[model samples]
Target: MSSMAERRHGISTPAASTQLKLRFIDRDEHVYFWFPLLAGLSELTFDPRQEIRHSALEVLFDILRFHGGSFAQSFWVRIFDSVLLPIFDHVRAEVTDTTTFTSEKRRQQEEQWLYETCTRCLQHLVDLFVQFYDEAFTLLSRLLDLLRGFMNRSHQSLAAVGVAAFVRLAVKAGPIMNETCWEEVIAALLAILEETAPEARDLITPPPRLNPAVAAAVATAVATAAAPISTSVSSAISSEITPASGSGSPSGGPSAHHPPTAPSGAAMANGGGGAAPVGAGGRTFTLREGVGARRLAKFRCQAATQLLLVQGCSEIYANASQSLPPGAVRGLLDALAFIHRHAHAADMDMDLRRRLAVQQ
Candidate 1:
């Protein structure tokens, strides 16, 4: 009677069908569907079209979110080798050009998008399988190598972004990172600061140019005003002009009118009359001699901030710090001091000043 009732309702056959479906999924047959999709996505990473690349990364992110944890270390290594290595190589090649032409600029924009996408995906994987990180030294070394390449590139914008990515990784993985890896990270950062320091010279102020029309008007007004001077005043002016003409002209040649050049050496010295001159408006404009120094100092401060944050969150940081070379610790302290000095010397933002103070 029960068998007849089950047949009538169609329950027994449907239950068997559902069980078969479950068995297929449990047997890992689902990989057949996902493997092809992932492979296609990985290939799409090399597509010249920006939208295709973006879509591929987005789909990959979704797939990773669902299956990243289930993958073995060997599988992860394969993914890194086959998928991520190509993308990183593409980015490195793109940034290497350093050209600012329209097409190159467009290409750079695309490369930046790809780089950021890869970074996010890497971060997600690192966060998802935190335990795998300790044993994934090879993976970390590859990432650092990529970042180092970016840092050494001629493009300041690209290099800066690379430094930022390095900082993010250091902060995220500081507690788990081995001492040797941490040292390498620090060395890379310091190298970036040193490399960028020379670029600060490009930021130096150029000599100011006088407007021709304004200069003509001023000259006419001065001539008209000087014509009516008394004989005594004229003699006094001649007396004052004689010495200047003598100093400007050798062998009693005609006095040449030359635009003033920016002073060097003694004129730029720190104290007395050598100090940077104040303008009529009471603003003092000083030449930027240490722009790179300031930038490096800021970089150090950022690193210190990350270290402090990691220390606050995990006891492993204490152990890691103890393992760090003494010079590295001293370098970090110097960076903090540099930030403090600059904050006090410049008209820095109050909020930033407060934050630095608190960090101190």
Candidate 2:
């Protein structure tokens, strides 16, 4: 427990602990001593007990963080191929299963822990020993797929963690992450925005049912009020009441009016105003002024803010911008425009919004 706590918080270790581990590995020039232990720990990662698996991952992460490069490239490759790859495979299978567990709550808890451990281990490995990444391209591809799967999951918490991990991986791997991976991530985030957008109708409560006698009286009152409109300019009113079409509000409910596009400050570089430019995927997602639009703008702004932060803090975006596929940079630009256009609409801290606007 104490060791686990120490590892979790990254407590500074004494020279003895670090030296002893290095000395043991150095003494075992053949790696006969460490290989079996690594295998055992890897096996423990799949243990039925969450604590055991978490503890095993903690130990492995610490080992990699402290002395990962000490081993030969081939040794690390073997660890990735034999140990990490299998764990990713298991995670994929578990995530795909549609079967209902006897104790769903417990299962969800276990799955969350598994995802957390997997993400942390992968991040640590990539951060500490990126030199071996090219050699492990196959494994890295699988890891990316696992991350995409996590992001596509219905569970928001899991998906949010997946997004963070995806960003971290991009920041760590830089040029190594290909365009296809970036597209997948961008698509997933857009889907999340669409899914989470709130409907104005959903926000508004329906009026309480009136009493039977009151309902009749209300209906009569409405009929009498409509009599004058029907008598005058009936044809004009009929022409104005066009059937609802795609240009109208979304299915969730009707809005008083379509939300306006983002402000000029949020417009895409190539676009003149707040109109949503087509993304790399050939989809145009427009921002409006209604509740749903505001909700979506909030999410889009937040996602873009995080991406921009990663870009500024690391070389990933700079490296990626040079090799970006057609429409990719535009998609990113659109996100940035949304952030700026609806800067005031988003329910975010004014300081943060100001910082984002300044970046724009």
Candidate 3:
């Protein structure tokens, strides 16, 4: 009995002692080895006993990978309910309402930890809860709301990540999803994804932003501007009119002021036609092609959003690979890639919208 009690302190065995030693953090910048936090959290998830395991789960500051054999495979509701849900509520409260605290220093400190821990735990729960999407709809829905909270408050990184995670859950939920779920979830993801990729800061801040990488990705690809009108729109209303100047009357001979014709095939410039003047030898450029275009101007106007999504997807795969086994990364990569593909489809929708505007 005495030995068991002592083991509970993480000192009875060499491995337990080492784990405890790893958790001994002083908050001193130099002595900090944050990576051990990963191992400790990993153990907490895989611990054999349910009660001790749940307790262990509480102190974790990071999520463990259950993708391969790394972490034990199991439905983690008891741990999630006993350890995660309450902690999520508390962390959420701490980061929210900066004014609730008396001092700015305290508020900022709380905000930093709150945001960090919030994200870490969120990823953990999401990774675990995903398998049980049908059974855990309520928990998943609440989590989606918590994630959206970051977006509502201008937490860009958190918001981007949260939206992406939520989208994944919704897709997995299949027919279980509803219209309200769409509003609470999918719409936000589309809105943020549409923002100018390169200027995430200009990309109208979602509720509270979340994932810095995603925001950075956004800044890398997109910008705020008019959407592309259409891929098939070869020329404007007045573009193909040729270089002939409008004549006063039919009796008048060829308009004197007009040149014979645009200098050869001077590559249609912006101001080339009769009403408008083409640039650089009466030839200007415009986008009239689809995805196949070498560099679609409509796409350029977005600041390369597709590139940003691909990068984010890559990051997701890389991060998951580090913690997960090869088998697990495949599903995660597939899901994230799906999100990336959907974002591209949304861009095409923007193209359609632009074309419709030009037509009307």
Clash pairs of candidate 2? 259-288, 259-289, 260-289
lDDT of 2 at 175: 58
Candidate number that wins on TM-score, 2 or 3? 2
lDDT of every predicted structure (CA atoms):
0.49, 0.51, 0.42
List TM-scores for all candidates, in order: 0.44, 0.41, 0.30
Worst 10 residues of 2 by lDDT: 200-209
Best by lDDT: 2
TM-score of 2: 0.41
Better of 1 and 2 by TM-score: 1
Worst 10 residues of 1 by lDDT: 242-251
Q: Model 1: clashing residue pairs?
A: none
Native-to-model Cα distance after best TM-score fit, residue 5 in candidate 2, in Å: 50
Error of 1 at 204 (Å): 11
- Residue 262's lDDT within candidate 3 is 28
Residue-level lDDT of model 1, residues 1-360, one tens digit each, is: 875697689767766565544211222455564557777787787577878877887777677666665565556666667665666666666554434334866767765665666566555545543445633556776677776665555544455555556556766676666667667766655554444332211112212223454446446658888556566543443432211111122112111233223333433341112233332223343333233234445445444443332333233234346555565565455444443443333223332223223222
lDDT of 2: 0.51
